[model samples]
Target: MKTLSFDGQRPCILQTASSVGKKEGEGNLTPFYDNIFQDAYLGEKSWEKAESKLLKTNLKTLLEKANESPENIDIVFGGDLLNQCISSNYGLLDFHIPFLGLYGACSTFVEGMILAAMAVHGNYAQKAIALTSSHFCSSERQFRFPLEYGGQRTPTSQWTVTGSGAALIAKGGEIEITHATIGRIIDYGISDINNMGAAMAPAAIETIRRHFQDRNLPNDYFDLVVTGDLGSVGKQITQQQLKNYGLDLEDRYIDCGDKIFDKEKQDAHAGGSGCGCCASVFSGWLYYLLRTGKCRRILLTATGALMSPTSSFQGESIPGIAHCISIERKTDNQ
Candidate 1:
């Protein structure tokens, strides 16, 4: 949590995005469209529609299960890919809560969670809502070119997913954070976007080790250690490299990117990056464990390739940053 000033209250995730796969933050946007690629969100849609869908799906779930109306929430904390976070505009259409937009590129999920948690942990407020979503088409058109066009993608490129994910965190509620060790964003500016696995692993390794140091948390203290979306290559590098540092994340520390899609069938080179990659996976898989009591203490670290097409085109390298936050189930909630 970056507190340049005062933080009112740390927030807890009240909802887990939409709690559905191919659905996460996506509502009615899933059906077939004119183009298969377009159906996969090849181009940007209207902000009005995009934001509305995010709010409708995520907010609907929150209202249904939390036993609260949109009016009761203290604040709505979120942001999207647009300049002013355009998707958030429509998300605010129906909800009457105060809104705040945040941007950390693909790291937005952890960023929101970190901010929300800090605000709550610091005794700022009782509850706050944090959420983030990404559209494959909207991001592509805005950041690069339309996905429908046959644009040459560098090997390091990661496909953005057409999805949205939201989480609600409440303090003195059901779930509680016994300890939180925050990681500073570390970057290695490597130019080749085709090989993000190499660029990002170092940061994840360094940050996780720091997490162990900050909290004196042994490698086995957690049931599972999860990385945001470093695909297979990065995950391998992390698993192999961490051993050299006397830190063993092992199989228990898994990568969310590799689990999201069938890499062999999806042909996702090194798997997906972007916001939706982690968002959808966390909503679909992690939420399941939270509800079913499969595993309680989870350390999830999401990474972002902090480079744009413009940066790559300008002969700059890809810089990677990872944010580590520990989220555990609230035994008391039930």
Candidate 2:
């Protein structure tokens, strides 16, 4: 079975925190963000260092909100879009906590959460942190072009979000991590780097389908079924493909990419992308809704286009993966 149920003392999302750059701060969900920086460089010498600072700020906010010291957190799982995951490495070094870095592209946050929850559930750690970040300036230089080039973006292209989000998972809280489904890498021969939505939609569809089947749950089981960084194109493709499989998501379906920014106003061609797109949205707005009881159940499936600049340069098709986790408001009876 692809899905695993944490039947024993399900791990809880104790707290969440987020920090974003000016562009993301201008988005509709900015009100929920913990910190916002007007400067893209975040007072650092380079975009890379700024990204590292963004991640550090997010973790610091999370620790403060949870009122826990670094010693209280047994382990931390984090990653980013930067080469060698420098953002998470340098950002978290000050905390002096044990760290395990991951690389799942845009799906990194969900990947970290799954690992953290599993660690707590298995008694490996009493508290664990799942975090990720991305910076637009840094990502563009690495994956596309440098800031000086002023490259034009395609309509299908997405803007990488400059932000970070962190979540603390422990044994007790109002929101429980109930189940999770690991995704399989699906490549449909899509080589266009700009059209990530098309390349990743298949994997999102497959993971959602498998989760529903494995859990014997209906389409409407979750109050909301959200995908990470699919933007407009990928969201449309996922909805259409799932319908073909006889599953109707209806209005409960949403994508973090689409939710984070206003396409028309923000000039975000397709919408937001990158690790921070989903991470910030989930840790900020979505967490608020769950905490306030506006939402009872949520299925967060973060998708990633698993391709590097080298792979794309070599004309290799992009492979996509997604990981789904179920978060439910703990009922009084439960």
Candidate 3:
């Protein structure tokens, strides 16, 4: 899937438990992970119920801020943590737009957005919204033990947050795609779930180097070059590795995982995880930065950990890949 790359519409901001603040500030919140799934332990309640609440809250916030209605939306491409995308399915039951369900692990946000933009650009749809979310409790219950269960996080681990993020992508609007460079999926099959940071770094560095090389774009072309979420370790490896390719991101490159939180002592080893780690923070701070002329151009490179039960059983290295896209502000006169 591809599209004419463009700047985002007015962005949306919704939080679950991220401890955002100053650089010297505390960091992302980690309290929710501790006792989140205890409610499930007590009852047979469906996962969609509580999650729908978070999704709806964020959706409503985005819709109201964008002055949009469900009927005005051409389609909603979404995904989340649950069997058959339960959160996305139940979350959009009320929106009434045609839905395209997607999954890219933590990279779901870009996958959805890219498809949605292509649909509108190709005249397949007039307008579409791409959204993705991840709740720490829901993920841990299925993937690992609850945090209150007192599991130790190795330095490579990431704390998933409980948040839903929505973006209202519009077509024939003030903003439009200006340039787009698609990336090939590069998987080394180095699958290690526990040590995700190192597993994901190679794919990220590969995609970033290729994207810049393919588009003939330099690191200074954009105000920031952002990655989906590689936690602290992956980010370091990516930066160092990118430099080897003669691409120095300098301080201009940042990680959504690290940026989502403003604090440091929250015990979140590296940073946040899940789809929301990138979607929500991008919709919030990045959007704010672009719309206000603070950031004129942005390069968002979302990475994925393509792991499966079968793959894990096969003891395959965590298959890692990354996709890259470039977005910038729309000039009034240009």
Could you give candidate 2's per-residue lDDT for residues 1-334 as a string of tens digits? Answer: 5698999789999999999999999988979999999999999999899999999999999999999999888999999999999999999889999999999999999999999999999999999999999999999999999888967889999999998989999998889999999989999999999999899999999999999999899888988999999889999999998999989999999999988887768988999999999999999999999999999999999999999999999999999999999999999327
Query: After aligning candidate 3 to the native by TM-score, how far in Å is the CA of 130 from where it should be?
Result: 0.6
In order, candidate lDDTs are 0.64, 0.94, 0.66
Give per-residue CA lDDT, model 1, range 183-215, as digits (tens).
555666666766776778877787777777766
TM-score of each: 0.82, 0.99, 0.84
The global Cα lDDT (0 to 1) of model 1 is 0.64
**Over the full model, what C-alpha lDDT does candidate 3 score relative to the true structure?**
0.66
TM-score of 3: 0.84
TM-score head-to-head 2 vs 3, winner: 2
Mark the regions of model 2 whose C-alpha exceeds 4 Å error after superposition: none
Misplaced by over 4 Å in model 3 are 1-48, 172-175, 181-183
Q: Report the lDDT of model 2 for residue 220.
A: 88
lDDT computed for candidate 2: 0.94
TM-score of 2: 0.99
